[model samples]
Target: MKRLIAYIMLALSLAACKKQNVKDTGPTTVVTPPVTGIIDTSRTSWWQKAKFGMFIHWGVYSVPAGIYNGVDISDPGSGHYGSGEWIMHNLQIPVASYKEFAKQFNPTAYNPEEWVQLAKDAGMKYIVFTAKHHDGFAMYDTKYSDWNVVKATPYGKDVLRPLVDACRKYGLKIGIYYSQANDWINKGAANGGFWDVAQNGSMDDYIDKIAIPQVRELLSNYGDVLEIWWDIPDEMTTARAAKFSPVLALQPRTLTNNRLNQNWTGGDFDTPEQNITASSGGRPWESCMTMNDSWGYTKNDKNFKSSSTIIRNLIKVASLGGNYLLNVGPDANGKIPQPEISILKDLAGWMRINSESIYDTYASPFKFTPWGNATTKLTADGNTNIYLHIFNWPGGEKLHVPGVKNQLLSASMLANGKSVNGINDDTGITLDIPVGPVDNISSVIKMVVKGKLQVEVYEQGPEANGSFILSAAAADLHNPNGWDDIHVENEGNPNLGYWTNPWAYATWKIAVKTPGIYKVQAEIATEAGATVMVASVNGEAVQKTLTSTGGYGSYRLVTLGNLKIANSGSVTFTLAPDPGNWQPVNVRKVILTP
Candidate 1:
């Protein structure tokens, strides 16, 4: 998680981060009460069953909305701002000057009950709010530091207390997002992703003086906290991370993520930020993502994801046996952005009709689905309910569900009780699906199975007639949990692609029938400069130089000189970024012909 390389060039003077009116602040003091036991994860089943939650990133940065000194940093491609939450670090606003914004940070419209009710309506079971962000701005009352909402702002009230109370009243689990590392105001850790070369205090001092005390305060103050989400472990050493373990004992069932230290092995869960991990290997994880591109409120940030996108994403995470922590960045007035509110309301409508498809659901029992994500849950009668979330409703009545070998009891549209008939066979079941749009965003079809659900493994696709198309969807992604996997790419297409890292690649398996000198071609889309793709099969390889097809969807055909095939057997094909030409490439389909 070290972003120092990206920000090293943008680092500003340390004096630029201090304010003239800064009051003398004392070092944080902490007293860890005696705790004797390790955290028991028995109660975390509730979290796994919940499937969906809310993430709120609110702080003094919302006041600026990414503007400073008449310059707008929030605008995309501005290159002036990175994360809205880290604008202080990005823009180099001194602590003294940043504190002045506290005078205008009063969120008069803030109502905890309203927030909690909205979450409930959306079918979200939990709320993880920013108790303290990396700017070292505490939203709660902290006795360890005076740089908090209650101590510095005109609001002069603890924001977290009411939120905790309301969540408890509404029967929603609550969690505090504490940036345990990367404190902009703490000594040594304040260097913006890098170690401070001119630091005057030791990291141990910061850990003992601030982090432990603030964490202790949060755990003690919050009622039955469900999680303590720590962000950016760039500065957290193994020993420093151990300090929080004592305080974590206070909340036996409260979970922590794996970011305490970059490579720290101790955490209750994995937190994949902004993008879904391709695989978690059965470990509990959550994908925390922002509705828009920015995590915090930015005035001109209008890249809000559609309600349909949000619903599908939630289903995507839930179907993968992970939770979806969708984010909402409220404006400075304490009101959730109207776009975000409308999106939540729209999601509420979908949840009303399909919550059962999500809650307590297991991963799909099949290898893959062309329509969309699938979920399953056990019924009282010992039946397994398979929920097929149809993103692209197959036009025909026969919806092919491949590789399912379970006894089917019944199939019906979840939105309504309408029955759906299907033919069950060895390859899988093919349902005689009902016509018409069941739901605009996503339609859920519930299929009941007789016994323990099981699915056939994926077999190598046939290369009939001496030709085969290896789709990006079936490619072996280089970065398992990155944006390059099963998500929408530019050009409004779903494929394996990324515009940033040039070295990213995807491999595919092929059936080498009638192996010989086969003509190989690639259908690609790009939004960047010219690049080359090295297509290697077995031991033979060829490079194809490519030009941008304009956008991510504007794909063009490029031929890689014929590759020699040895014998007729299973073969491996790898498409990788041609070294030295670090440009973006999106390969949708790799075609091999004899």
Candidate 2:
């Protein structure tokens, strides 16, 4: 629901982003600059280890089930297009009309134990359920408002307490998803509405009388809340955000996400929606993705992601040291979509065999791999365990791994525990790949390394076509003076630019097989006169004087003289300015073709 709103806001702000450096204006509100807070590792250790969880966006939105007044929620002809949860805002449904759906919101078939069991069987470490959403409808029995399930709905019961109990009974942690702002039904609350006169009330009054008290009720009543999932801080200022901090302080160990208020700096983790965002150094993060196109249950939404994609996404997130909070939206009758259940069953089967590679794993040591991703962990015996999640099994007998400097102790298939052979060299190691993948979806190859994990930077070998591409994005920059301007950038494209320092250089480790004469071409852009650079390999060198290719951003591939290689082995390749006659140049990549 918040994800859909975010995309719309991004589209509307694209022009401003192109004109100047623009920051994210979250849901019609200005986001203050981020504040840094001391991160307590002790408070986050359990969450970091729990790399996967379940997200439930169940709400009264399920009552409409993506249809309102005989029109589809996303019907283009009706001029409405958004997620099921945003039906009220997108279709401009009045608060009075929207409240009528609450009368029909019944979940008699909702079995808390069944939901918890499904999550546990799917190998999820925790479950985060929607307690309240943007429509100002609470799934729980909040004393502050009659716009709650217990007082308004036919089912007339609190949904959260039983879910929490079930999670505890099944030894799984539970969290609550609360929308602290943009309550459409509450008078004076900030909301996306012009027609609903009932929504005209003081924002501060809504926060004090409704949002804050409800938050306090949720945190205090729910025993041992694992996380506090706040969404869409539309008009929540820092002062308003601070009101909930004391309520959260009651449960000191409960984790909170960044969306409570973008200005608030005391979040335990970042919540990146619908995408596997890159790791922010070692900061805790989670990607909340849906099983299909919608976060809330849409009866007509059948755009379900494949089981393979879901599995690989989980692996990809774990490899990057983040959690995957996969979502499932239950219908009004409390039945999960059939396709979602089937996907969960598939995940259950896969996790039953390959979960050891995921749990408590650190980020990959290598920068990138052709086949798939990797995760590592330090063993109790002082060794390192590298779990290779292979999406594309190699056709040849050998599966190459670059940049690794550790000695391989043992290799085995995690699925069946069968021994695999590994051959080591200075460049990296190669695993004797099996005839076929043990599991076709994604095979986990576990390799134990001796001592601490050591990986050489910017090391690579030839692709299947026997061509070596030393890209500037992967180059190891050497700045002896510590103020060298030479660095990789993406101005027009990804290239090494701002080469003002003559002493600084870039290098790559290449493992050459089937040694022979290879054609070398460099993609460089420069306006300086007759810039000379020395490209060197094991005792052999090529000194080339390059001509201008129009401008610094206008790149052209110019052929550089090739040198002979005496042997087929790993060697260092260096590109440095010719000391006496050096000029600035932007380098994209150097290609060696045999």
Candidate 3:
């Protein structure tokens, strides 16, 4: 009882820990204000406390994997655009052709208990299965549409029912991801916005007949769903979004994503797909990413992210007050592949040691660090429990924590309960670390400090004239595949997003010492021309087209024009394509010069 009281008190005092002086930037930087009532409101979500979860994108697409009519999907000419899950639309397989997979969709090996047990063993708290993706193939037993699993498949059973039951049996929170729009079953699902099929129907009839009723069935039939993950609200309007409210009224506690309309109209949280979202105004957001390049099974694609990358991504998400919904694409036989299975085992090993740092914690109030990320859970007392997840551990006897004012009570390695000597001085707190990292993945340095945390956020670099060089390393690649050295994009091309996505973006959260219309110049080298690089301060943006540098990797620094800021604060620069289409470019860094 006393502990509960202490926890409440800690929660109340959490806002006081936000450092006013720091330049706010996430591992990948982009601070989007979350919608009201849905994002981090007075009523905290149980889903937020349950930090980690699983995202499964399964359907008839698993049967095709990547090939359709002997056409290689990797080739753009093959009409294969996006992930393996979208193979139906990408290959332009007629509705008649795509329906053939449903007949053969017999997951006789689909063991719900095994899948749930695997998730539990991986230390995942929840599961968000793709009950229905853009393909419009419903995995659940839906009475509204005959295009569902029970009627269409040879297995002739509700695939999702056993999974939901098993989740309940295993004490895991389960949610359903329903694609609100883009029902390829409706001929026009591939194209964005509204498309009418003369023979089949309009999107409106599809929604009224299939979408709304199916949602109602999901909430009513499923026992206590934590989330109703919605996707691709292309052409979704406010009125269309309103139709979902009745469905949500069935399950008031169930959270929805922001993509309910043209903008983030209806959602309990912002969903940053395949990338860590930069936390803003303390919003409740999550990053849904896949293990491999594709969300669903892809036979030819073997570019699976390492176990260490998965662990680090989790830390990065937690550090920014978001959940990590890692994905796995099961095969047509409903078995998770070997590489994905191995990665989950690795995650389980890591979580067993460091889940305390992840689950039930808000973003760290302290400033950012290049080495890694941080997360803080307020203790029963007013003291803050800070978890320093050292990803790029600099080999040194002493680890320096600059500009933090707090009374350090204890310091220990989470992996091993070995206590480390702490030294607090005017230079900030320095911990005496061992000769090597405690764990190769990410070593957690758990520090329990008394009272609220006081952290230094802004670091001023040496200015020459009126310009400052912002290192490429400091800029946050706010995408899912945004790593330190390499740029990662999970979709578009089977290889990555960078090559295929025209709207690829990276951000830099610059702590401007001099607030003015500083010249924004980017040191870049790429093979594309007529490409747009949009530089912006906050949301105010300016664009300029670029010609190719001498060649790929041939370098040149070009001025992207100027951006104006009102006062000395964190100025965000979003480097992305101009507007309509995906443009390609390789960026080193953006420098602000007067």
Pick by lDDT: which candidate is best? 2
Model 1, position 274, has a per-residue lDDT of 69
Error of 1 at 173 (Å): 0.6
Query: Residue 430's C-alpha lDDT in candidate 1?
Result: 84
Better of 1 and 3 by TM-score: 1
TM-score of 1: 0.84
| Residue 11 accuracy (lDDT) in model 3 | 30
Q: Write the per-residue lDDT of candidate 3 for residues 520-579, one digit (tens) a residue.
A: 888776677577667665445667788889765576889988877666754545566654
Point out where model 1 deviates above 4 Å. Answer: 1-43, 193-201, 264-266, 476-491, 499-505, 509-513, 525-556, 560-584
In Å, residue 404's CA in model 3 sits off its true spot by: 0.8
lDDT (10s digit) by residue, model 2, range 408-473: 999999998999999888567889989899888899999998977766533366888988888885
**Residue 478 of candidate 2: its Cα lDDT?**
52
For candidate 2, give the lDDT. 0.78
Rank by lDDT (best first): 2, 1, 3
TM-score of each: 0.84, 0.74, 0.81
> In model 1, which residue pairs have backbone atoms overlapping below 3 Å?
17-94, 17-95, 18-94, 19-96
Clash pairs, candidate 2, are 188-201, 188-202
Alpha-carbon local distance difference test for all models = 0.73, 0.78, 0.72
- Minimal lDDT window, size 10, model 2: 19-28
What is the alpha-carbon lDDT of model 1 when measured against the actual structure? 0.73
